[model samples]
Target: MNLLGRGALAPAVPVFRVFGAMNARAPSASLAPDVASRTALAVHNIEVVYDHVVLVLKGVSLEVPEGSIVTLLGANGAGKTTTLKAISNLLHAERGEVTKGSITFYGEEVHRLSPNELVRRGCIQVMEGRRCFAHLTVEENLLTGAFTRKDGRAAIQADLEMVYSYFPRLKERRRSLAGYTSGGEQQMCAIGRALMARPRLVLLDEPSMGLAPQLVEEIFEIVDQLNRNEKVTFLVAEQNTNVALRYARYGYILENGRVVLDGPAEALRDNEDVKEFYLGLSATGRKSFRDIKSYKRRKRWL
Candidate 1:
């Protein structure tokens, strides 16, 4: 039941470990060696319930250190999205609420803040499925992320260009309707829009869903660039365990609304249980579909 006690998971492929050795950037606080002291966001034993009835999240707790990438990994329906929505205060829109515990951003309690208030505090969420406005031009969709800023037009425009620098493909498609762009381009737009907010923390959900493998790598590479260059912290919820581990410094695995396993990303990559269950690998090698199904029925951490 204690997966963290196991050996480290396998390392992600070479390309995915591009930023694995970079040092953590100092936040507003004095440089601290430990993650706890430098945490940008902390979710402490929070529980989320939908419509005051269906309990969705049960004591979910995780942290994202400032200027670091931390991933939440799990299968579909494992409460990854709910955890993100809880942090961004978007739960209220869906009739869901965090019924207990606390969520803090930059050490201030924020579970009660409005979604826009959270955004104003430099925290934002890019929802899954590339939620771009169908009728809006790609450039228009990116600019909307700046609505909360009181900063003048020059600053916002500068940030827009910065977004274009990171996502040149988006600039190429800027005049096109977001709904007309390819899935990968739309995903880039969603993230580009998040960048326009100048957020210190971005809670990204399922960024790789429905994109080709190459596109997934391209997107994550941009994430790496943003983290290193912009000092933006990311708390990513992704089903693509292999790619997520490659780019993130740390990872948490969720199941049925609870954190089942967590460790440094390299450790998670080499973990046998993670490889077997999430990555479809075992000590013996890649698992066949039948083997995976059989193994799933008897998951050790379940």
Candidate 2:
């Protein structure tokens, strides 16, 4: 059964152990504009813990600009999803908390807000898996995303039409139960549902997981289009560096709950370490992280 139930909440909060500690950030109310300022979401020196003991994020920090796509790259157990959950305020659903540091959206302290409140504030997260309401039709599933809105029916209808326009496959499958749809369609449904919220920022977690390369390309194209046309900012957490970087303007690589490397997407694509280790194109043929004895820690990602 789909754990999140039959509607907007279908993608239940992910449960996992956390891993770090860092400094704090004061709250701010002013959202004044500045050409030098482009941040939409900021995770500042955040430290997350589980059961009040096990640390998961150690002084982790990053920024997502208001009108660009940012990619978070990492392997399993690298704290990528945990970081997303922390930003969405979904950690509390799994008995986790950001013990230190501050999370802000548009200069406002949002770490204190509830998950739904975060949604209300133009921040929404699409979970790693293609989680959809198995029992509900695709269109009904999309409507659940509007539950938090007080907007009139016309605006909601327009948004729904917009979602369908973005995912036409979804419109074709509107009457189909989400569980009965293909992985790609379900993934589209998940993203379309988030779009229904008319979010300014979308925290996309592994949209390429379990999908074919072509479908991944198609999905990302839609995401890129959404960013370009609708001006929605995206913070995508993905392991598919090849695809993620292709769409993102900047990239951050996480390892063991800390940022190991970060740079412009194009720059990171040409980075020796990224090419040799992540892209599997070493001079001596492809080598796994475990097989490379000389790949020492360049620096402690504090």
Candidate 3:
């Protein structure tokens, strides 16, 4: 049932091979938290480059409010993963660098901190592709998340139980090699591992990729529960706008590495442009819009 096959421990599985760059000027703080006091993670106009030539992420900016779920939505190759890596400082390994702008977490400059330091500060990024240690057991992979922690064993053990509570399927596969687990279980293992880090902010990349619709819903339900019950804030980058918006309080739509639109999730669901361009709907799903405006007055989405 291993839908992901033998991918090994590639947490940030590379999907796109190309990168590009442009002059990145910090955008206005319009997207910064309305209450600066509640901001957990902030990225201001960052430019990313690969191998000092190919550039990606042209001055992207956004904010994740403390203890809130925010969805970053876009199509494939929209620089979503790059933005997450830019914040986690993982770009360096890929010959990628944030050539412009800044990132802050809990009011501390993230560029100045190592990846481990960010984890220590309760910031973690659960990379895409549901990467699990192919040779290791599910429990072992989950324990790896706590490798940077020096906290007492008791706390870690308690957290392990908590992860099991959130992902019972992972518990069922606890002793199985991660490589053999189903795609859904591996995805659960990835998120459970991040939880072991006790992160205050989790940058989740594509939680719904390569799974059955039912499994996707189940995982998202767990995410919502974790957010509500544990106060774990999430900034999820996903292409599945329909599912993501259901749980997110706010959303930002990115296209070609730029913020094209952003607003409360409900408002986005009603936007003509979003409905057509992102949702693939041509004002045909809802009849209320037609009732509210004449056909001639309806805004053009394309």
Question: Per-candidate TM vs. native?
Answer: 0.86, 0.84, 0.83
Query: What value does the lDDT take at residue 22 in candidate 1?
Result: 26
Q: Candidate 3 overall Cα lDDT vs. reference?
A: 0.79
How does model 1 fare in lDDT? 0.82
Task: Rank candidates by lDDT, best first.
Answer: 1, 2, 3
Backbone clash pairs in model 2 (N, Cα, C under 3 Å; residues 3+ apart or in different chains), count: 7
**Predicted candidate 1 versus true structure: per-residue lDDT over 226-249, tens digit per residue:** 999999999999999999999998
lDDT of 2 by residue, 1-302 (tens): 12112212211332211211111222111211222546898899898876676667766788887887888997666778889999999888777789999999998999999899999989999988978989999999999988788898899999999999999999999998999999999999999999989899999999999999999999999999999899898999998988998998888887666676777788778876677656766677766557666545421111
Q: What is the lDDT for 41 in model 2?
A: 89
List candidate 1 stretches off by more than 4 Å: 1-37, 291-302
Model 3 / residue 295 / CA error / Å? 19
Residue 181's lDDT in candidate 3? 94
lDDT of each: 0.82, 0.80, 0.79
Q: Which lDDT tens digits does candidate 3 get at residues 90-181?
A: 77777778999999997888886789999999999999998889999999999999988898899999999999999988889899999999
Over 4 Å off, model 2: 1-37, 283-291, 296-302
